[model samples]
Target: MHILNIGILAHVDAGKTSLTERLLFETGVIDRLGSVDEGSTQTDSGEIERRRGITIRTAVASFTLGDLRVNLVDTPGHADFVAEVERALGVLDGAVLVLSAVEGVQPHTRVLMKTLRRLRLPTLIFVNKIDRAGARERELLADIRRRLAPSCVPVNTVTGIGGRAAVTRPVGSTQEAAEILAERDDGLLELLVEGGTPSADLVRAALAGQCGDGVTYPVLFGSAITGQGVPELLDGIGTLLPAVSRSALPDEPARGAVFAIERGPSGEKVAYLRLRAGVLRVRETVVFHRGQNATYDGRLTALSVAGAPAQREAVTGDIVRVWGVPEIRVGDHLGGPGPAGQAHFTPPGLETVVRPRVPGQEPRLHAALLALAEQDPLIGTRTLAGGDTSVLLYGEVQKEVIGETLARDFGVEADFEPSRPVYFERPAGTGEAVEEIQRHGRNTFMATVGLRVDPAPPGSGVDYRREVDLGSLPPAFHRAIEDSVHLALREGPHGRPVTDVVVTLTRTGYSAPESVAADFRGRTPVVLARALRRAGTIVYEPCHRFEAEVPLETFGAVTASLAGAGAELRDTRRRDDTWVLAGEIPAAAVHEVELRLPGLSHGEGVWWSEAAGDRAVRQSTATR
Candidate 1:
């Protein structure tokens, strides 16, 4: 059977979950349809997700249709959970981007489209919610073409009252499809010149080629709630989308990428892997390669398809859940020996301290957060010396979800303090430090080390190199020095992660027979700290990129409001009597703008913000 690993993505309230439930029911995977409001869908199994009616994480389900087996990944729609979407995209062969005919294209819709195009994934656009009272399919399509992409060509259409009926016809016979193909495809042009209609197979073949190449996108219409156009949608997926070719010999070694990580009900770590080559079997040792030639090996104790019983083996193109791999992370690649590519997730510009609501669940809270961070790296955390913990956040919604998840999944209640912008410190000028051999105080192991700190170009993270002779120190002691240097820089002179700097070892003087290797470990960090303090540092604060749509009458007020929040306007465009404003602003002021938009625009305002990296703050002000 052909396997298709496809992901479903859309903006919040775009009926993505409803469409997923409909597909499962239509394909006979479920006996009845599940409601998104009730959150009883097969993919959304978390209690918090069910109660909130929002997808907080990515979920997967499998169903069979004819000779094809489709593994569908339901990704979160809210911008707060885009990390979930990023991880999902790594394992997919194709995608279905859902758009609401009522709401048209949205900010997240554009974001997802850009990522899909960048990754060159074959995509099908589903214009959903046609049964709604305000549905305007034509206008929505035009909006998609203008704002999203021009390659969006309709594959099916809906008619009748409330669009209760739908049908699909040969792509070659339709004027729109024929014209699109004839203009670009020589074979279709020759057929048109011969006064002959292209066969369904030929048209589908051409579409698969172009769509997979990212040159075209097929648009299908439907109301997922009423099940109208659903059957046609499923048929199109099975027929129009490309399938994985099974040409690998059975003896080839198995290779896969770990795209997601989660904890099972039994407290075992589960890694969701997309097998790309050969076959994987139980008890087989899988070698994972990560950054800097790191390798982790584990025996697969069990393997299973999404929500299914354990299996002894998984073939190529299968999304399998495996156990007994505790060291596996979200981006680890197994079998084939090379570092895997990582998903480009927007960094969290805001951060806040997370404290346990109860008195002494501190360890539990940190452990829970560490587990969560392993699953979604965007939710990174920092534990201070006094045991205080802070978590990075995309927005307040994500913060709330983290607290709710800890309570629901781990049975520990937690609360977050007011969020603040995260900052980074970088070296301002070149500096040097030399530590002389000493046998007093904390320097039990006598050693002498010299280091130079230099500024690096922006975005160049901390780099360390040594220029010492190998005979002076063993490789183990050299490694200890590098590790200590990294730990010391975690909280630099300005109390933030150090970036865009190089810490190099320039000199080392220690008696080969008198120096204890462990002593260098203790002195290395101290010397690096001295060097960093002398280097002087500058602070940079996080910034966000925003886009808003406001009525022309209120554009001035909105611009003034943004300006007050330390925003730098990038561009402004007029669209259908509405002014679209784009700019960059301090992340700390985003909430104030969100709160004031409703009253400023009489509830007709829509705006969204995403992390846009960071910028150096005023020289006189310091941020920690």
Candidate 2:
């Protein structure tokens, strides 16, 4: 049998979970359908998830279709949980992007579609909720084409839309389908130009091939609640999408990635691993690679592949859960190296300090936050000078969920301060510093180091280079210098994370027998810090690009609110009976603006924003 890993993605309330249930029921994987409102869906089993009716983590389930075994991954639709969606994207073969027929193209939907196209992942568009009031077809399709993609072709036609009796049927080969295919196929274009019609079989083959190549997308309309057009969707999944064949050589080494981490009932860590090659067996010790130049060996005590009988071994293309690797993290590679995981979206730009309401719970709260960070590394946690714990955040909803999770899972109640924007520091000028080995008895260390700091372009991050000969010191000593430089830069002269700078090792000297890696590690930070201080630093605040839609009557009040929140209006236009405002706003004020928008617009306003990088702040206004 073939294997295919597909992810279902959308904005919140687009019926993504509902669609998952419908797919499971249609495939006969479950005895009956489960509802998200009732919190009985198989994927959302967490107490917090059930209570909120939102997916905080990516969930995996399996079902069979003909000779194919589909490992369906259901990802959270909320923007705050976009980190989950980003991680799942690394392991998927294809994706189904769900859009609400009523909402048309939303902000998050546009973001997801942009990412899918960037990754060149084969995708299918499902315009769901067709049975709901105000649902649209022709107009929505035009909007999708204008905003999302132009290559999207409808494979089926919907009938009785916007009613409980809405349904869909396959629309055989049509002019649009032919034209879409011909856009990328020379043979098809030539046939069309010659007035020769291609057979339905030929057109279908061309469509499938192009779709798998990520050049064309097939759009299908359906109602996950009513099961309308669901059978057609099933057929599309089995026929239109590609199935991967993992036929690795018998001698091939194991290669896989850990996309998720979950704790067992007994609190042991369980890793969700997707093998791309070779085999992983029980009791076998495997090397796990975390980031660059870090590896740990752990034995697999148990293994279970999805949609298959219990076995001692799992092979390529298997989504298996393995035990005994407690040190594993999301995005870690197993066995050998593969493509480095890319960040599909900007990380959280705001952070909030969390304090235990109950005295003496600080220790437990820290530990629990650590565990949560392990699961979603993007929610970075740090300790402040006063011993408070702060966590990076995406929005207010995530903040609430974290509080709820801590109370329910760790038995600790906490209060979070108003979130503040996380800032960064950049080098202001070039500077050099040196720590010599036993020079005038001024240095105690046996190793000598010289570092130079220079400003780099924005968004370049930190770059480390060496101007000294590699033979001047052992490789271990060089590694120590590089690692310590990064660690020291974490707290720059102004106490903010430093970025967009180049640090170069300009000088090196070491005693033949007395020099050690520890000596270099201990001395390198001191030299780097001196260079940074001499260079000075400038602070920058993160910003977000925002779009606001408000009724014509409320436009004046909404604009006033935006101006009061430190926003810069870049464009303003009228869309029918509403006005659209587009601009950039400081990240710290985003939540406040969102809160005030509904009231200002009389509950008829919609707002969306995404990270727009950072801008320099005046020294007087910079947060220390």
Measure candidate 2: CA RMSD.
2.0
List candidate 1 stretches off by more than 4 Å. 160-175, 178-201, 246-251, 307-310, 336-341, 426-473, 500-510, 526-538
lDDT of each: 0.83, 0.90
Give the range where candidate 2 is weakest over 10 consecutive residues by summed lDDT: 335-344
lDDT of 2 by residue, 282-324 (tens): 9999898887667899999998888885766888888899999
Candidate 1 is scored at a TM of 0.89
Give the clashing residue pairs of candidate 2, or none: none
Q: Number of clashes in model 1?
A: 0
